[model samples]
Target: MEALLKEAPKVNHHLDHMPNMLVCENLQKVYPTPTGDYVVLDDLQLEIKQSEFVSIIGHSGCGKSTLLTMIAGLNEISGGTIYVDGEPVREAGPDRAVVFQSPSLLPWLTALQNVLIGVKQVFPSASKAEKLEICKYYLDKVGLGNDFHKKATELSQGMQQRVGIARAFALKPKILLLDEPFGMLDSLTRGELQDVLLEIWQKEKITAVAITHDVDESIFLADRVIMMTSGPYAKIGDELVIPFARPRNRKEVLEHPEYYDYRAYLLNFLNH
Candidate 1:
């Protein structure tokens, strides 16, 4: 394990070089149900650097989704602030694109049309050919080239999720937010999508924040895995650094001596 740690590359290279792309300061979220006020998150603070990929994990109902929504500016913060590139996040904008667990595609629109919507919205000044090229490039990147004309409802769950990913990447947002985007897929399909996501992220170099429950997935994808505690009031419990080199492979990573130690450390943290 010590030898593997020595061999592993530095974990925070992107953070050291890139400017802060997103910052959350003492973030909190409260809900007013019919019964009373409920606190979902408490004093949650996080930072994501430009071109960094961060994965957040915790027990169910740990406010993981709530935190992502708040960062995406889809949900209002109860009391705190989120800044994207030094400016406060006031509402949803093209600068931040999100891919939800359900894919959230418009059933009425074809996959090509769905991607075109994001391209048109983000690059209205560009010519029609430019928009079409962007849409086609992303759809093909996500392994949806042959199905571009298919409607959302006609595609499988995994295919629909691919469209969602392609659309989010097509927008070329300053930050990409994912809320358990692969949680519903089977193991084989999920692994395939993860690889595709990594390829796209490396190509685009976009900042990203992903909320997931899978420990191995987090370790494989993120430079750092931020773990939160279960909530009525959830907060960050630990941050695990993944020192594995880029262009990682699941088989090779598992064979490394440090893999078990790192996995065990996170498992202990989560189980405790």
Candidate 2:
């Protein structure tokens, strides 16, 4: 276990001093079972700074999704609190938008309509023309500009996921939660969207927390890779700072001197 835990990397001065955009302190999630109670997470602590991209990785059933949904206000937190921009999270709000494994687009709506539903919710006061431009801008950013009117059902799985990404960003959220957003896509599509996501994040600079199983994806995208301990009482196991500077180049990041070292450390934690 000691060998698996590497020395924490040097923190970036720019991000280190930024105010925390999201804070999770002493978080607890308990599920009542017939046998009694099952504790899923205990005293978990996390803090993400403004515009920081953090990737969460853990062994199967380590409560990664549980933590994420609670932060998004989709699931209840049995104890403790999740704070965004210094306010406690009590319920779901537009300030936080989630992109799940399944894009979950409404099949009957055109791709543009699907995005408009969310945009309208968050920007009720914006003019019709403004809303249309926001949705169209994000859809174009995600590479779906030409297919705006296509029904969700007519789009490929990857295209549907693109719509989901477009919708999430169109809300201009303070924090974004992604629960394996590309988990269902093929490798090719997954990689392409990863770049698209990064480009958008670079421009928006919104704080985001993403749960992923792929180590490579985690490393390539996040400023910090947060590793969680195994459940039935999962907590943060360790945190590793990604050294490559952004806007990150995939080839350069893959060839980075510390890339393999970071990868080995992560794999060690899961394997041991």
Candidate 3:
């Protein structure tokens, strides 16, 4: 067990020379109400390496999603700064793609068309043939090859979310931000998508940060789990390195003893 635990830190050692793919320093978020300013997050610092999958988990009001939005450059930061691939992020760009909790698909467009819209926007310089190939590839990658002609209104909720995933990956962003993208799926569907996502993360090695409420999901998906304290002025309280090797199987992960230990620790942290 101790040997298994040593593997994650070893991975970090080789990445010391690589510049961080994402960095958040002394991050702060505040919202103004009629009465006074409400502090949601303060003095938070986080760094994610190239291709690392990290999950942030905390209580409902801990500003987890808010932090993701700031990194995406969709929301203004009250203080501190965010850097992606060594460049400071000031606005949304093609370099980053985000998938939110609700599958925000254009209801009128077919799955292929929906993905093409994003691909064309992000890769406008590419030839039309190239863009069409990209759209087809990601939609197939998400197991939606047969449903390419279906619109959002004709698809199940799970299938709609798959379209969302395909659209995000079609952009070929260097970083992917997920704000509880699987929160609404059933357990079986969630597990299927988790494996699909992990396969893509392994193949592409894109830096990913996800905000999740499920402890088991974090253990299954992340290289490290960052836990936040209860709000107001919530910050990273603790973190656990998930030492399980990649190409991870759900059954194998469940059989591992340390998985339960990590689960217990996270449950305790959130409960207290």
Against the hidden reference, what TM-scores do the models get? Answer: 0.94, 0.96, 0.94
Can you tell me which runs of candidate 1 are displaced by over 4 Å? 1-11
lDDT per residue as tens, model 3, 1-272: 34544533534554567678999988999999999999999999999999788999998988999999999989999999888988888998767899889998999999999999999898889999999899899889899869999888899888988888888888889899999999999999999999888887788878899999999999999888999998999999988778788888999999997777778878878988
Candidate 2: where is the Cα deviation over 4 Å? 1-10
Q: Which candidate wins on lDDT? A: 2
Winner on TM-score (2 vs 3): 2
Supply the global lDDT for candidate 2. Answer: 0.91
lDDT of 1: 0.90
lDDT of 3 at 177: 94
Return the clash pairs for model 1, or none: none
Clashes of 2: 0
Q: In order, what lDDT does every prediction score?
A: 0.90, 0.91, 0.88
* Pairs of residues clashing in candidate 2: none
Candidate 1 structure quality by residue, lDDT tens digits, 1-272: 45544655545864687788999999999999999989999998888888888999999999999999988889989988999999999999879999999999999999999999989999999999999999999999999968999999999999999999999999999999989999999999999999999989989989989999999999988888889999988999877778777877878888977888888777888999
Runs in model 3 deviating more than 4 A are 1-11
